[model samples]
Target: MMIAIGYMLSWRKWFDEQSSRLIAKLVTQIALPAYMISTITHDFTAKRLLSTLPDLRFPVLSMLILFALAAVLIRVMQIKEEHRGLFESMFLNSNTVFIGLPVNMALFGNQSLPYVLVYYMANTTIFWTLGVWLIQRDGTHKQAFSLKTTLEKIFSPPLLGFIVGVLLVLFHIQLPQFILTDCSYIGGLTIPLSMFFIGIAIQRAGIQNVSLNRDSLGVLSGRFIFAPLLMTLLVLPMPVPILMKQVFILQSAMPVMTNAPVVAKLYHADEQYAAIMVTETTLLSLAVIPLLMMFVKSGFIT
Candidate 1:
């Protein structure tokens, strides 16, 4: 619904030419950093924080395997030189928060929340670091690869905010109540603004422009097919609780990272391509989900 609204507003010329760029800036620079801080500070407490780290290994490992596969696919598919980076990023990363969180809560109930966050933590960290690095390559700017530039890209605002929040939690540092409230209020804008960005991208791309080409089909297969199948193979053999395995598998099948388009736009990469994939996969995920539930219900994972 929010996405539709963004598209409508864009079609009506309700926004200026710079609207999408500004929206991306607002999200990545302001809203996302604050969101990273607030969510980490509030969601994970001191005691369980360490306990959760062990579970974190699962997602981290899952991403590493996915990354290897994406590398192979990039060479095999002969993805365009510019898009290779973004392709690898999208193929590996999942939208574990916006879509994954609520979906897990709905399907598996609150008991799965902890496992969901574990996946979110790993996904968020990698996306900001390695994922952002990959997107930079797809941009117009020629990356010479210096230690300085690498650090700057890796420790972007959102990642810094995540680091700050983690340090605060680990050291038992507490911000005043009002400050926490302030972060919460500003950070809350991340979702609506992102939906608007997507809508605007779709509007600009036009329904006529959207099509399932080789690139689009590869991304779809990565998200809906390869992703979950890989997760199933990895987690199926583990001794973890069934709920945690289920959450990990479902989270793996989530839509492309919402940040894919955001980071792509920020770096002057193919934002339109990113936006189209997002829309395509998001719509397909809705249909694919019923079959996914059937798998879970049928004890396929167990």
Candidate 2:
């Protein structure tokens, strides 16, 4: 529905390229950070972390392993260097924040939030570090790697919001209720705004530009199928509760991160391709989610 809304709005000219850029800035820099702070502070606690941390490590480790696998697969497929980063980032990362939270909430209710945060930490950490590097390296102009510049990009507003939220949890500090309320109100816009940006981008790029080629097929399959399978195997043996295991698998199965095109544009990579991947995988997830639930019910995923 969000993508549909974005597409319709763009078709109607309510949001063009310039307006879309502004929306991207607000979502990534302001709204996303605010949302991160609100969710992390509200959901995370040291006691909760103590219990969930061990299980959380499973998801992080699984993600790292998947990253390695993605690198190998990209090499085997001989994907061009320019497109490699986008492929790797798309293949390994999932939409943990935007899609994972709500899906988990619906499937497991409010009690599952801490587990979602666990996946969020892993996803955010990887996304900014490795994900940003991929975008920059594959960007329009390639340059020698610099640790300092990379660090600057990685420590973005969203990550900072996460860090501050973690600090609050670590120190057991509680801000006044009114402040949390304000953050909540501001952060709530991230998803809708993000979808709107995608909508505008789809219009600008034209849906016909999105092709179902070899790379696209590889990406869609990797995100919706193989990634989850690999994570489920890694998660099943963990000592955590069953629900935690399920959350990790479900989060892994989510569509490609919605911010892929936004980050691609920010770093000057193939934003058109990135936008296509995001749009296609997200639309396909509506079907994939239900199929995954069936697997879980049949005890195939566990």
Candidate 3:
């Protein structure tokens, strides 16, 4: 609902053209990190982090399985060379940082942070490596892949914030009272700012432009349907907490990575298609998330 309001405001020009990118940057670099640091420190302890290590492997392993599945699907579907990278990315990665963070926080509160970051770490690792490679490989110019660029992307502000938070908790370091309070206030901006950015994205993409074609349907299924279900099957048998399974399902159903279009544009892939898919999945998630939560609360899946 807040995201819809943001989109409506952007569509009405209440936010200027530059506002979307500005909000995205603010959320990604500043607000997100602050929120992450505050949440991680407040909620996670060294003992808990060590105990949760076993379940942490599932996110990364699930992502790898999905990537392999996407590859086979892409080949079977015979997706055009131009769209192959975007196709793989849409299915393989998710907007775990921007959309997943706020949604999980809303649904499960601060306790969801450790699980969210576990997924984020896996998501970030794959997105930087295989995700980047896919974009570059399908790009027209075909620039040689650089290790340095990949490392820089993996270690972006958001990931660094997670790392720092974990370290602080592990080392039992205390943040200054004023600094912690300040971070909490700033971090609170992440949800609103992220939602506002999504609105701007939809406005820029023009909601009418979203086409429910075969490709779009395939991408949507891969994200909201297949990914979550697959994760459920994989995690259900494990002795992990039910909240872990719930958080994984929620994050899996999140929208396509918001950066899909940006990465497509950067690597000279099909930017238009990427943008359309991103917007389409994001809008759909407004509906899908609530419905999924109902099932979660009902214990329908356990």
Candidate 4:
């Protein structure tokens, strides 16, 4: 598997710590944006795009409910004060782009991408604003909100790519065939690179350090249980498309944000603790997906 290869390479000294960061940069800053453009343009039209935008409310509302639940669970779970914010964040946000994108595409194919992006749009915006603030609260170092920085993160490369792809569709603009092909090739790297980054991160972060205490379990439950259950309850009653419902449920169950540790470290919070949770949740997600897909495909969910 791609993850095993990344782990093996790291173990054998072919990849150092910087390898994961560089790969993450290459994926997020380059590959993913290209992927967004390629998929959006090919798969979406203006009418479909307009309809999808309002469905964004499903994920946004789901997260708002999870946010409230996170606040309560942190207290009930008695997560350490120093790490409470990161715990709250990890509880509410999912890895919508990293693990979520590849897994959804693998399970549901490219037709699922527009809905995937819809979830990503809501997920990314909330994580950068409210989620970042919460993690910062956990840290000893406090930073005032910077509109410029916040805007930069919120309008991240992938989102911008989605925006560009939408504008092209909405305005009936078409790129040269060769340019789209070029983007296709570059975008092809996103999924494999993402897997590689995770494997490398697990190796570097010492999966041995992962602890299954209240903090980890609470987050695990939030991702695997509360998040998906809530999404299912929401969209199941709504008149959404089946594929959209599928995308929402699967994405809601994705692992915690891969950015958790980065934000934790950025604010001098418990980066080690953050990294451990990221590893545990991500690793568990691998196991949960097979049964999850089986359940979803069984028609028990709709």
Candidate 5:
């Protein structure tokens, strides 16, 4: 949390528009692909890759359930149709990549990496397909799924790494020492670079004209508290493995993804509201997540 906050603060002075653009290019085009290739090269195996699919069952289900709830909440609040897009956008896009990945690694170590890979793959698939469909449902002209966008999201560097890693593992292929070392060096940049980009993006989108009163509070509560609580109740009763359970719970507990606003903009949703939702949830999750983790550890939540 401190790290994320520090990046935000530093961005005020250090991150300019040009640098932000460059970072976006790097992340979207270059670094992400590199990260995917490395991860796929290292972990891809026929059996392990197949095993990872079952782990996805709960997370994907939870996402659908939460998305429905979010839609209902938006309607219940009587949010204008124009604003409903923002509300619906909040439900589906969890922080699976930047925040979730690092925390999962810290909590579960290398063994859990495969789970992270599958979760993210499922996440990107859902985000580009279902998520895009939802936000653009009310647009003047509906946006069809673009192959370019789909491929970019699916083959993003980190995801490609997962795919390659699984393939290698499946074939029992050994990576040369030099390739392994170089991949490690390049893959190491993903977290910091992504986080810094997020910080810079937030900096560029200054926190002015944000609505933080009751309506805003409701959005934050829905994303940070209500959604996770609902997921916990559903997930804890399931007979999935403990690691899978923890991963589902933790990912559910994540703040809104940074990409929420981008999607909102694309669909002509309330981008300001989306930004507020992302900011509020990200700020509040620092407290909420650790406490929730404690509850899970004590078997209180389960």
Candidate 6:
């Protein structure tokens, strides 16, 4: 309900394209890195670091399952070979950092923060290395996996923030009170900015070109339903902590990342199909996420 209202409000005409672009840039380049650095810096510790590493394996395995399911679904649906890259990328990648972090924080509070960070770190490492290669296998972009590109991705602002944050934690450096307060304010901007960016990107994609093709819907159904269901079932029999289980289920249930289209565009893949997949998943996930969360919480399927 709140998500719908937020979407509708964000779509209002007053929030023009220029404003949207600026907000996206601000969130992407400035606010997001700041939030990540602050959070990581504050919580950095040997125990937290060690604990966070082990928690990452579940999400990684869950993502692998999603990747297999997406590949199979693409083949079964007979989506064109040329467009399968778009489907694979869109279906496999969730917005773990930008979208998932804020949602998990809201639902579960600070205790779940480390899980979100670790999941995002795992996501970035996999997507940039394996995911990029998978989507760009046709050699559409010669620049894929070059040393320069790999270095750029590794040294990106978010990853750099994580590194610096950990260093700060190791040294036991204390952030001043005003700085900490500011960090909190900046971190809070992530959610609204991410959702607004979604609305803006969809608006830019032009609804006229958006397709509800059978293949696209198959990907969406797989992402919103099958992936989460499978992850819940997998976690059910395991001796994992309940919080980890909830985090996995919630992260799995998130819509395809809004960044999928951007990444596809960068790699010179089928950007139109990527845009369609992103818009479809984002719009539909609102309906699916709440129901899935409720089901997971009630132990109905798990």
Considering every candidate listed, which one attains the maximal lDDT? 4
Where does candidate 1 stray beyond 4 Å? 71-86, 95-142, 239-247, 257-275, 289-302
Candidate 2: deviation at residue 274, Å? 2.9
lDDT of 1: 0.79
- The better-scoring model by lDDT among 4 and 5 is 4
lDDT, candidate 3, equals: 0.85
Candidate with top TM-score is: 4
lDDT values for all models = 0.79, 0.77, 0.85, 0.89, 0.69, 0.71
| Model 4 Cα shift for residue 68 (angstroms) | 0.9
How large is the C-alpha RMSD of every model relative to the true structure?
Answer: 4.1, 3.3, 1.4, 1.0, 2.9, 2.9
Write one digit per residue (lDDT tens) for candidate 5, span 109-203.
65667776777877777877777777676455567778898778767766666666666777778878788777777767766766776666555
- Angstrom error of the Cα, residue 283, model 1: value is 3.6
Per-residue alpha-carbon lDDT of candidate 6 for residues 1-302, written as tens digits (9 for 90 to 100): 44444456556665676776687777766777778767776655656766667777777887788788878887788878777766776666677765677778777776776677777777777677667776686337756358678667646676666666666777778778788778768866877777667766666666667677866887777678776777787777887667777877778767666666667777787777777777777777667766766775775533
Q: Cα miss at 5, model 4 (Å)? A: 1.2
Q: Compose the digit string of candidate 3's lDDT tens values, residues 144-251.
A: 778888888888888898888889999999999999999899999999888888878888888889898667877898998889988988888877788888998888
Q: What is the lDDT of residue 252 in candidate 6?
A: 75
Looking at model 4, which ten-residue stretch has the lowest summed lDDT?
A: 293-302
Runs of candidate 2 exceeding 4 Å displacement: 39-44, 75-82, 132-140, 258-270, 293-302
Across 1-302, the per-residue lDDT of candidate 1 in tens digits comes to: 77789889999998655988798788778987787678778877767555655888888888888889888888887888888888889988998755676567668864665677678778877887788889988998655546675567556676677668778999989999999999989988877887777677667756776688767877888889988898888889888788888888899998888778878987899988887787787767768877887897687777
**Which parts of model 4 have CA positions greater than 4 angstroms off?**
none
lDDT of 5: 0.69
What is the lDDT, from 0 to 100, of the residue 29 in candidate 3?
A: 95
- TM-score-based ranking: 4, 3, 6, 5, 2, 1
**Per-residue lDDT for 1-302 in model 2, tens only?**
78579889889888877888788789768887777678878866777656776665777787788778878888787777778889989988898865676677668765676677778777877887888777777888666667786566657676677677777888988989999999899988877876666566656766576678767887887888888888888877756677777788888989888678877887789887888887787777879987876665566544
lDDT for position 140 in model 6: 76
lDDT score at residue 140, model 2, on the 0-100 scale: 81
Better of 3 and 6 by lDDT: 3
